[model samples]
Target: MSRSTCVPTSEPALVVAVDGPSGSGKSSVSRAVARRFGLRYLDTGAMYRALTWWCLEQGVDLTDPAAVVDAMDAMPLEMGTDPAAPSVRVGSVDVGQAIRQTRVSEQVSAVATNLQVRARMRDLQRRLIHEASEGIVAEGRDITTVVAPDADVRVLLTATELTRLQRRALELHGHAEESAVAATRDQVVRRDRDDSTVSQFVTAADGVRTIDSSSMTFEQVVDALTELVGSRTGRVPRAGSA
Candidate 1:
């Protein structure tokens, strides 16, 4: 938690790559860290979800990898990088919220697990990262390994299974009651299990920092990442500011 003495007076290009399992708060924490450092944010998972939503809309068979790849090639997707209000748009339709639907959650893993789909996404993600003006915080299952292995900072944020289930249940159902948690099992557990087939997110790879956030509040996790970023990049803010 100590600040670097060589902290730079002004911000520099810094790409922070974070990967984690479902409900591990990767997206939210990454966004918070990006906002703290005046950086862009990228939710790589949203790309997959957007693709899934598009595939479903186009009636592309999820089980057919070739068909899904065709759909992926034809899909027109746009991603907004602002951490404060990031968005996903497919063609003229805004799917920022639609991609988070239960139906999409249930099938996104199918598309994500496709090797061709992952390859295409990796290329696109790398392009976005390279084009980020001020730098970016990109989070997803394989970001730390595949998408941005050379990111300035890499973190694997994770939590206990019970905690992950409760958190996801709260997000999806507005409550973490037993019933809600039970209902969310498939979305958190099953989706993660399926997606893991293509990405290694359950554990941190070499040189990546591991942050077990089950006991940390959202603000605490954000602070931890922000501090890590400052330490790694020496791009610290003035004392007492951000």
Candidate 2:
């Protein structure tokens, strides 16, 4: 894998780009990794969800491409940088919880697939990465390939479909039973299909390391990335730093 890759810039804001499928535990693991190393955290997926929530709030039709792009052009999204308490707000309403609702998950793809919308969000994500003085861990579907390909350390976390489905089921339903997995499959499988049309996240791009989290526990996943960062950057956070 390409874990030893490093950004050549002298800037102190280390941008760690992490891209992965939805059920691959990108958000939670990214947050933990950022906290461990004392870096800002950005959930790029939440930005898309926030836009979807805004479209829904304003009764914008997702099928209308022009309308969706216009809806996101001026959307006021405030993403919290704290790893311990990551938050997403639109205007003054905290839609952090609302964005994760099943409703948003189902319709978010419509907004995410619009080329114009993605371009705008991509610019915002790049600006966020640039503005983080203490560095930032940015995780989403396209961070490695599109958002910040020049990131200091780029990682592509992946897992088998069954493993991803089960993990997502457990996260959504608190159990990974047959019924729960069935219910959660579309969230992973379908959204991935929809997202792939616009971004190449199913496989690792050149120079991006891939970590298979199928058999790994959550702690193990975090440790692997932490060690990878250490291998590349020459420093790893001590245990219990988070």
Candidate 3:
């Protein structure tokens, strides 16, 4: 796509794009940054996961790009941000719980790989960014590269493979069988490979800041990101307000 194809926004609204593999702490850090700045918090991965859940509910063929494309046009997705309680809706039904299932997690990558699916999803993401007033903290694999290439601050958060796997295991706790954690880890790695390979998505460049979360606490990550935002914008973000 040409650079001119990207939508331009009026005024510098401090768009922050956070990209990382699953369990790398992108979601937690993005939420913290949004809370600190009072910016709109958008979890783009949840959008894809919601679509995955919807497709499964509708019995769409996961491998068929055409069917996935058709379903994409028909699904209605709504996201709510409470910071304290975030949720996602598909149609009029709340599917926040469904989106996090192992089934959806296993299928989301296959569904997300369809070019038509990505295009449709990207359009929705652009609308979310456009509609935001103060600013937005958008987190996803392609946010810094495709969705918001010109974001004021782009962060690529990463952690050691073992650390990520441990974190995922903790999150799953009683939700997933203990024996399935390794399989889930493999799935996440495979999905990351597929997304980066097929989509040609790059998270960070020479100037983009990369944060290693392997040795950092959640609070430390937030503090570093807040400082980065301040350094870039020339103003410290007002904790709990933008």
Listed per candidate, the RMSD to the true structure in angstroms reads 5.9, 6.3, 6.7
Q: How do the residues 3-66 of candidate 1 rate in per-residue lDDT, one tens digit apiece? A: 7688567445789999999999999999888888778999999999999999999999999999
Worst 10 residues of 3 by lDDT: 198-207
Residues 33-65, candidate 2: write the lDDT tens digits. 999988999999999999999999999999999
Clash number for candidate 2: 0
Distance from true location, Cα of 82 in model 3, Å: 4.1
lDDT of 3 at 155: 83
RMSD of 1: 5.9
Error of 2 at 185 (Å): 1.2
